[model samples]
Target: MSDFIKRARAAEQAMRSVFPATPLQRNVLLSERYDADIWLKREDLSPVRSYKIRGAFNAMRKQDGQDLFVCASAGNHAQGVAFMCKHMGVKGVIFMPVTTPQQKIQKTRMFGGDHVEIHLTGDYFDDCLGAAQDWSAEKGGYFLSPFDDMDVIEGQASIAVEIEAELGVPDHVILPVGGGGMSAGVTTWFGDRTHCLFSEPAGGACLRAALAAGHPTTLDHVDTFVDGAAVGRIGQKPFDLLRDRHLSDVLVLSEDRICATILELLNVEGIVLEPAGALAVEAVGEVQSFIRGKTVVCVTSGGNFDFERLPEVKERAQRYSGVKKYFILRLPQRPGALKEFLGILGPDDDIARFEYMKKSARNFGSVLIGIETSKPENFVRLFAHLDDAGFTYTDITNDETLAQFVI
Candidate 1:
C-alpha cells in the first residue's frame, strides 16, 4: 500500500472514537433491478448526514492545540465542521452564502450550539470562501478547507478503508465527484484493485473540466441545484491526485435527471437523498452493462435534502421524463377558434398553465401553455392533433437558454 493509503487507514481507525462507521448494506431492490450485487455505502447515515464529518474529525484530531477553526460552505461541509467544533470543544467560525437555504443554516447552528458562530456573506459561495480565508488570516485561526487540504483528503480516504474492510473487495465502485477530495482519496486507496466510476452533476462538472484542461479551471457559470456537489472549480490539492485520471471514467449527469433518481430512490426504496448524494446511484443506469452480475458499491454521499424542495424536484423529474411540456401557441382572435382548439385536446392531457401573451397580429394572439400527461408519448399524440387542426405552436420544454430568462 502507498504511504498515503496507510495513513488513511490509520485515520479510519482513529475515527471510530468520534463516530461509528457508516453502514454498507446490500440493496436488494437495486440488486434485483440491475441484475448486479448492489450495495450502498451509506455516508448519509453519518451524524451530520454526510461523509464530510469524517474529514472534519480527522483534520481536527491531528491539529493538537488548535483552538479555533474557520470554513465556508453552503451546506454539508459547514454542518460537519459545526458538529465537530461542538464535539471537540473548539471554537469555529463558519461563512456561508446569504442565499443558502434556511434549513441548512438552522441545522448548522443546532449542531454547533455555542461552539460555532455563522456569518452569512456574499450571494455566491466563492465570495463567502474568500471572506472566510481573510477572516481566518486576520483572526490568526486555522482555516479548514472543505476539500483542498491534504489532511482532509486523507480523512476522506477513510471511506475507502471502511468499504474494503467491510465488503472484502467489490468488482466496481461508484462515487460522486464534487471538488474531487472524496474521489481522489478513495481512488488512491483502492488503487487498481477495483474499477472506479466517477459521477458529477452536469451543471458543476469541475473534475471533468480539470481532466480536460490537465489542471483546475474555473467555470464561468454553475447551476447550484445540486448544492452539495455543484462546485465551479476543482480544488488544487485534490486535482493533483486526480490529474492523471482518464476522462472516460468520469460521467456527467444532468441536474434534472438527478432529480429523477432522487425521486426514484425515495418512492421505490424509501431512501431520501439530496441531489448530489444521488449522483453515484444515478450513474448505475448509465453504466448498467459494465456492472451486470458484478459486485457494485455506490457511495451515497449525503442525505441533507430539504423537504421543502420536494415539489421542485418532482417538477424537474416530470419535465426531464418528457411527461410535462411548455409551449407558446398562436390562438386565432375569433372566439370559435378557442373552442376548436380545446375540442382537439386528448382525454389524458391536462393544462397546468394557460396565459395569454399579447395580440400580435389582428387575427391572432399568443398563448403560453403548460401541459402535463401520464406518459411522454401523449405529447406526440397531442402535437399531431394540433398540427392536424392547423394550430401553430412552439414547444419550449427543452430550451434551456430561453427557459432561464422566461421560466
Candidate 2:
C-alpha cells in the first residue's frame, strides 16, 4: 500500500474518536435504473450533513496546541468547522456573508454551542474571507481553509478509506466537485485501482475550466443556485492534485437538471439532498453506458437543504423537463380573443398564469401566459396550433434576463 493510502486509513481510524464512518449502502432504485450495482456513500447523513466535517476534524486535530482557529464560509464548511471547534474545545471565529439564511446561522450556532463565534460581515463570500484572514492574522489564530490545506485534503481521503474498508474498491466512483478537495483526495487514494468520475454544476465548473486551461482559472460569472459547490476558482492545492485528470472525466450538469435530480431523489427515495449532494447521483445517467454491469459508487456530499426552496426547485425542474413554460402572446382586442386562444389548448394542458400587460395598442394587447402540460410533446402541438391561428408569441421560458425580470 502507498503512503497516502496508509495515512488515509490512519485518518479514518482516528475519525472514529469523533464520529463513526458514514454509510455506504447499495441503492436498489439507482442500480435497477442504470443496470449497475450502485451504491451511495452517504456523507449527507453526517453530523454537519456534509463530508466537510471530515476535512475540518482532520485539519483541526493536527493543530495540537492551537486553541484559536478561524475560517470563512456561508454554508456547510462553516457548520463543519463550528461542530469540530465545539468537539475539540477550541475557540473558533467564523465569518459568513450577511445574506446567509437564518436557518444556516442557527445551525452553525447549534453545532458550535459556546466554542465558536460567527461574524456576519459582507454581502459576498470573498469579502467575508478577506475579513476572516485579516482577523485571524491579527489574533495569531490558525486559518482553516475549506479545501486548499493539505491536512484537509488528507482528511477528505478518509472517505475513500471508509469505502475501501467496507466494499474493497468499487469498479467506479463518482464524486461531486466543488473546490475539488474531496474528489482529489479520493482520486489520490484510489489511484489506478478505481475509475473515478467528477461531476460539477455547469454554472461553476471550475474543475472543467481548469482542465481546459491547463491551470486553475477564475470564472467571470457563477450562478449561486448550487451554493455548496459553486466555487469561482478551483483551490490551488486541489488543482495541483487534479491537474492530471482529463476533461472527459468531468461532467458539467445544468442547474435546472440538478434541481430535477434533487426532486427525484426526494420524491422517489425519500432522500433530501442539497444541490451539490445530488451531483454524483445525477451524473450516473450521463455515464450509464460505461458503468453498466459494474459496481459503482456515488458520494452524496450533503443534505443541508432548506425546505423553503422547494417551490423554486419545483419550478426549475418543471421548466427543464419541458412540462412548464412562460410566453408573451399578442392578443387581439376583440371580445372573444381570450376564448379563441383557450380553444387551441390540448386536454392535458393547464393555464398556470394569464395576465394582460398594460403596455398595449388599441387593436392589440400583450398577454403573458404560463402553461403546464403532461409531456414535452404537448408544447409542440400547442405551438403549432398558435402558429396556425396566426398568433404572435415569444417563448420566454429560456430567456434568462427577461424571465428573471418578469417570470
- Cα lDDT tens digits, model 1, 1-407, are 47897789899999898899999999998899899999999999999999999889888888999999999987889999999999999999999988777878999999999999999998767778899999999999999999999889999999999999989889999999888889989988988899888999998899999899988999888888888887889899999888878899898999999999999999988998999899999999988988899999999999988999999899899999999999999999997998898888789888888989899899999998988899999999899999998999999999988667655
Task: Write down the worst ten-residue block by lDDT for model 2.
Answer: 1-10
Q: Which pairs in model 2 have colliding backbones?
A: none
Error (Å) of candidate 2 at residue 260 is: 0.4
TM-score of structure candidate 2: 0.97
List model 2 lDDT by residue over 1-407, tens digit each. 37777777778889899898999999999999999999999999999999999889989989999999999886888999999998889999999888676667889999999999999997666668789999999999999988888888999999998899899999999999988899999999999899999999998899999999999998887777887887788889999988998889999999999999999999999999999999999999999988889999999999989888999999999999999999999999889988989999999999999988965788999989999999999999999999999999999999999998889
Model 1 stretches astray by more than 4 angstroms: none
Model 2 local distance difference test score: 0.91
